[model samples]
Target chain A: MPKEYDTFVDDLSTLPEGKELILAIRDLAPGNRKYDTRVVKAILASSANKLPEGDILWLRYQRGSLRPEPWRIKIIDEREGLLLKEKVYDT
Target chain B: MPFRDNREYIEALEKAGEVVRVAQEVDWDLEAGAIIRRSYELKLPAPFFQKIKGYPKGFRMFGGPLANFRRLAIAMDMPADSHPGAILDEYHKRAQHPIKPVIVKDGPCKENVRIGDQVDLYELPAPMVHDGDGGRYISTWHFVLTKDMDSDWVNWGMYRQMIHNSRDMGGLFLPTQDIGVMYYRKYEANNIPMPFATAIGPDPISALASCASYGVGRNEADLAGGIRRAPVELIKCETSDILVPAHAEIIIEGEVLPYKRVDEGPFGEYTGYRSSPRMPRPVYRVKAITFRNDPILTVANMGVPLDDADICLSVCGRTDIKTILDNYGFPITGIHLPPECSGHMIVVAVQAKYTNIASHIANAIWGTKLPYPYIVVVDSDVDPYNITEVLHAIVTKCHPVRGIRAQEFAVGHPLLPFLSLEERMWGKGAAVLLDCTWPLDWPKEIAIPRKASFKEIYPKEIQEKVLNNWKNYGYK
Candidate 1:
């Protein structure tokens, strides 16, 4: 099967530049997610290296919904600026 | 205990850690509006801009002066952390006693005076409060003072005024409003210019009193004096016979000429909508401008809830409704007009002794001077201040078909966005009454269900334990 969408890439810079990204942070986080581009750009410009494993970053160009349902992601493992993870679903 | 003037109120706010000063250069254009809007959204302290971009250092603009309950409490001379209900109770208790004002020879407002050609309206840093506003408004928080031709009754009213040029401004003067339009009609009959004086920053309590629903031919200055429990000091205006607060920060003396109309409005009103269109209205000709050195301009930022207008108007509405209901001998427990509704919704809690008691109170409210169109009558058990409890009462006790009543034709506020074109134009609207109380004639065997609540369901000891351990359970 194609690499699962939950699989995290190494450095955030390694991900395809134009692909959509989604932030799975708490509801009380500062800054609005409606302007996804600015949020992604700010994240990339930060000093953090590896993506939190299982975190899904949806780029603006890829999403159709203005405000999508909130998604939860959990980090599994990190090695050499890379993150490997899996999505957890409730039964 | 009452503030003598606006300066005293500002100093009190500053001492209470409720004033924020900005020294950076800011534009009087959209930038100032945006900053004030953001501050209000954040529920921060009142902002005082000391350095407007084009204006000099002495000139200042204050935004969201009474945004927080703590600030309002201080302005009313109550303890800083007093509850809103207590403040209203105090105001109502004081309003019953009327104290007349004392006129003095001179005060700080006369430190500098400009008359004739020296008068310039553009010198003051009036801000464009919203992007879609028609123009910069200068008299958002101030009161326009006018007197009747045949009587000595002086009226203080809050009306929006737009700056048009160096010496002239335009404003809306609805004929139904007590002071401006009514006075203009009397002047029109005699064919004379109606003398008027506007005070920019007077004592905060006096400004609050202007928003009350006192009947026509009653002097608001006297009512303000009653509320303050001390006589207000009045001084003569330069160009008119009108009297203004002696200690006001700035005063503008002028006249409203009969048969003269100019274009005004599209300004965002307290209804949270820019519903009013630009149309021809009365023009105010400026004859004299008086102020203290480096006077501060107070602006009420409109278009959103929890602003100065919402707080003051709601307090005034609650006090007036309570006093009216008490005079009628209705068993009233509480009255409240939530700020978020912008004076459109009124909630009354009462102990109903008869079947139609709720309906009677609602109809009486409709007949009052308050302009709210939606009213909710809840039983004494429900807390009028708690929106969730009121909603629960409506959902559980009210029957959709039997408990609701509607008055097809009632006086509607023109600024309400939901009104039709005809209703807005004619100033006529409908009123709805929601009776959220149980039927008194229900069978005794079919007992009313008890409310399922923590205090109702749990044992007394358990409830007391939970309450005492609330902080320990990490429920801040």
Candidate 2:
């Protein structure tokens, strides 16, 4: 339901096929921030539209708050290193 | 009779203090789902979200509508304090009479409409349930309406659905399910798109009726009416001829395209685990959307025990099994599929009429629609709903060797985690039957041992005296 999700989905859909890899990180703290289940699910869902036939590394963190960085996604193109990276969304 | 619609059902829940109205803003992203999950875990009242973070003021959502037996009792129009077994008995009795649904011109679901280019599922607040799920699940607790191609049979079932952009939705449609069989054998076989309609937040009985494991060709609408003890009012879908509950809060009319598939699943399931990995599944192409002015999206936050799916399956599955055994002259007193077992096990209490009756009961169950793996048969004196009583029978009366019968290569459910990869893919696994009833051949005096329960060990006069003076002698 967030604007960032739509933007991410668009980026994934338009990517060049078989050229990029993705690294998705989600924060799963023990406290209220544990609500990041949606962040994990949404990332997996957005990855469904990925045109690139590359590996996806899903990582979970226990860092207590700064929960602002609940989820981060980085697109890595073999030669370009990091292509598109988003570190923080609406907290 | 059950409540007329979700509004009436909610009122009953509210009066009984079984639901909480959440007035604060809650994010549909994962926060809303997290609260629902916690509610189920704690056996708390249902949560009605009056204010969602991004949605309109009136677009509400409900979480864990049937989280406990008390709510289920209210859903069935019984006292909120009724026992679990009593509720199950009431449901089983209602299932015996299938009243037909009546058609109506228009209803609350049609108060607002979105058609053609106006349809956008993302506009609704379908929450992302679990962290590792596929996407925002739009149809967790709703019943999908699909009719038979060559007959008048219409099936209503709750199949988990995920959003695939705007007009497209992906969901599980296993070839073994009723809708799957109809689509695979008839619609897809004939190369035709299967017309469908989905109703969210219908009457309490109707929503549960959709999830029941009834036989094919028997309409769920009729079963819902039977449960309500009154005819369910239905209205025609805008794009398709399919009928949906007139009082439904929201309705989406669509078609399942022939030979089309989309990425679905990895969502939280009733099995208390994340469902199957993301893979291509059948897609439903939305044609129209209809709803009330302030529609309430019913969310079935599946996972863990005592959730809506658990309550529905326990009561509905119990009736299905009990009916089958009764028809075969098994003399069953009760049959329960504990929501805790997540549909993998069933406990049956039966009077021993002859020798080795457990195998016949297992065979009868395997032939039915939903064949579970672990079946436990206890004496009629034992209450299947009481897990303590069931476990006692199993540990004491049942012989370690003679009572447990394991059947290799038996029928199975595809979602069970214990099955091998091959078995999960093909629905083949080992099943067992545990006979806890005393053998009829055992002599009355010496061979059969006496139970240590209060009813069996205490004298009638002493029991009466204890009960009569319990409060006077330091009890609460």
Candidate 3:
């Protein structure tokens, strides 16, 4: 059976403020040559205390990369209440 | 102050601390080309090669002549730190007043002259620019002067010339360009060889004017004169009636054979790709060569982004498009053709008062002389020069289905690498229009949303306070 994941992040409230975050999506399944792993970076604005739900975060897929897949977000690093780094896993 | 000649311009650059003198002997084959390319990629100072492997002491090569923005700013008689918008404004302001050329009896270009059997092009150390180039090119930064047979109007254009032999060179004259339509077409239809003169290193203003897309019958000599705020002094060619810059470093008088065609290209073009295939094009037969004592050859190494060609195209394209839109009474805020796209994409910021104004602007841009295939129109609030802001507008305001339009058949530049061999051969292509503006039919509440920006959400006092105390708040 193929592993499945969510394509969208349900909660972005956990992301720290005033820090840069890299939303990395990786393909975990082996022998899938067509799928591509990529990452995009965005900063959490300090002025905004909270991120509204359903707010869209545009992602760019590389040419010949896999289409949108199930993914989960993770806080890779946090410093001084600022979101420093992040990664998303997709199976 | 206006530069008297190419040498004077180089001197000014050196005095301004924007040029580097490379005294070490470098081979013309690839060593010189690699150095020039690397300098452009790294945004280094212009390289002045004083010693080429086979050339003599006086023979020199200046590479990436206009790659630096500050260098371009200095060339146009502006401040070294002048912004891109200021440079474009200066060009537009000067273009309104054209000063004609004044013919002179003689100049430095005539210090040495060779005709017939004595003329040898190989003596000049022309660098083999790219590794995939078909041959060494001697005319990348040079301007070709041609005149219509029936009309007195003269046209100056920058066209690449590849060295074919000791006396012959191959080049391209696309039918859509002003030079091909106004001058070459007339000669080709009549089966008569067109008289031409190639100015190797004219003043910097003349070189800039040569790359611009001035309308048909527009004389670039006058434009150069206008940009310099003085009439350019011209000296008549030895074998042709076409006049060239009197203070030019080197001038070659030649005749472009209308009936003759020679194989040229498969070289790397300004599009950041090696897309042009080897094909037969017009050949220029050298009849006379003249130059000053120990003339310097100016070369522009074209391949990737941030090169001299990108600088020229961005400045010229922006000025040309802005002038066109303004003349048509469009309330345009700003226009920019980013150099990263190699003049293929244009971003226009305009004030929309009526319905579908963005769509109208996009269509109008397509009809202009610009070679761009993709155009994006944004609201006045958006900054077209800022790529990130423009992309955000495209993402938020644009509807992928309704706001995007495509034309199946559009005039395309022959040098565009993305086109297939058949499409390029037929000179047929497509153009796209992207409108990144709010819909006019929607109500204010529906069309507008609260922006998540500091200036938009926060009160003016709080925003100002935060900005004023930014440095004190541990923000460097």
Candidate 4:
């Protein structure tokens, strides 16, 4: 069987070269998957401009943890914390 | 205050407490899409992701703006708590008088422009909205603006486009749709590329107008203007002569290569299924990608009920059926495409004045681009909007054989799950009109069965007394 991505690419240099890829900053961790992508986003966005167009590869790192069914994704917190961290406390 | 742009609409949603700002980063690879889908299912406020996982700070996304009737009502400048029926009436009334769009020199979409080789479609985070989709789609909630090659007619339609590479995208342009008519009949036949521009994250009304079952040559921009009761400002495209909504968050201008076909889709469409197969479709060779600084990409999770498409087609598809019937002089009191059926069925309440009126009604609906498989026509006494009334009529009033017409070779949508690949390709299928009205030519003195209800069976005195004494009856 083919392999599945369990963790995000921390080192972009190890990624395969010479093919068009969909670069997504994903985290395979549980609960923190939603927020964990932030550090990876910064990691990729920092170097994305320098990378070749066809070489951008995205590894969809779910690790089969989060809800696969779209309807199963729950929205529990209806608070201002969901907004910008600074703006939530500004006013 | 009225909505003129996507930002204005978001502001309106924020003011109404109908928007949730996701400060936490959401992955575009499916997690963001899941959140958007959940938002629709719960009938919650629009989810505006301020921070996408893969993109920079300014590039945000707004999903399911008109996911509920309340948000839809706000989009149309109506009361937030307006009933869905009244919202439909409001939309239909405004659609009667289309206000032509006004052209402007420059707009927000022109704020940041990348032309030719500078265009990288990946700069905007195109969400892979559903798992197992063929690729990331760029145009889910947007409208494709294309002009008729032979005439001055321009059409704006909601067609999905998937990004193939840095400079190319592909989408399904069905032959039956207006865009397909322009592309296949005029452009492809003549061996010329068709000029096209798509506006993403326009005001909510424009998106609804784009999905409406508009006849050929009926401009959606004008219908949008009519619904909003104000002219939609448009800006000239960079690469093409086609104009796009001025305040749109982003505009992708390109040309459809005449003979070029590319692999596209297996998307989870509005029918709550991946109905359309992954196949070769028309290619959009991107010439320019223009947008406002820090663009807001409108994402539509079109898999199940109460999604953006369902919320829109519920009103628009019903409007088309009712309008077609009214123009043909059928005495229809009300019509509804329930959000539950996802536009697969329509219920029409009518006064069956003559023989075979149900057939006429079915045929009228079938003639439109959006035809429902289940056409339930009941008597004027029934409420088409109420599913219980429609179900009761279908069970009791409809005869075994005579009252049902299982129509073959009816127009079928590509997104319909039941159709075979070949059938969907040819746009042909079967439909059944459940005629629930009593036969007009029946000879019996009391041929029509009595309907028992507070509105139908009870006398004025009894209904009044019961309604007046409801408090004493221990009913709150």
Which of the CAPRI classes, incorrect, acceptable, medium or high, describes model 1?
incorrect
- Count clashing residue pairs per candidate: 8, 2, 1, 1
Models sorted by lDDT, best on top: 4, 2, 3, 1
- Is model 3 an incorrect, acceptable, medium or high docking prediction? incorrect
Q: Best TM-score goes to which candidate?
A: 2
In candidate 1 chain B, what residue range of length 10 has the lowest lDDT sum? B176-185
Residue-level lDDT tens digits of model 2 in B1-476: 56778888888899999889999999888889999999888888889999877788899999988878899888888888998988888998999999999999979999999998999886788888877576678888789999999999999999877876567777876666889888988998899999999998898888888878787888988899999899999999999889899999999989987777644556778888763544456778899999998999999898878798888888888888888788888888888987787777899888888888877888788777675888999999998888888888899988899999988877654466677745664667678898898989989788998887778888999889988999999997
Error of 1 at B148 (Å): 0.8
Give TM-scores of the second chain, every candidate.
0.95, 0.96, 0.97, 0.96
Model 1 residue pairs with clashes: A10-A82, A20-A58, A20-A59, A21-A57, A21-A58, A21-A59, A22-A57, A22-A58
Candidate 4 positional error at B164, Å: 0.6
What TM-score against the true fold does each predicted structure earn?
Answer: 0.81, 0.84, 0.82, 0.83
List candidate 2 stretches off by more than 4 Å.
A1-91, B459-476
Task: Judging by DockQ, tell me the better candidate of 2 and 4.
Answer: 2
Clashing pairs in 4: A22-A58
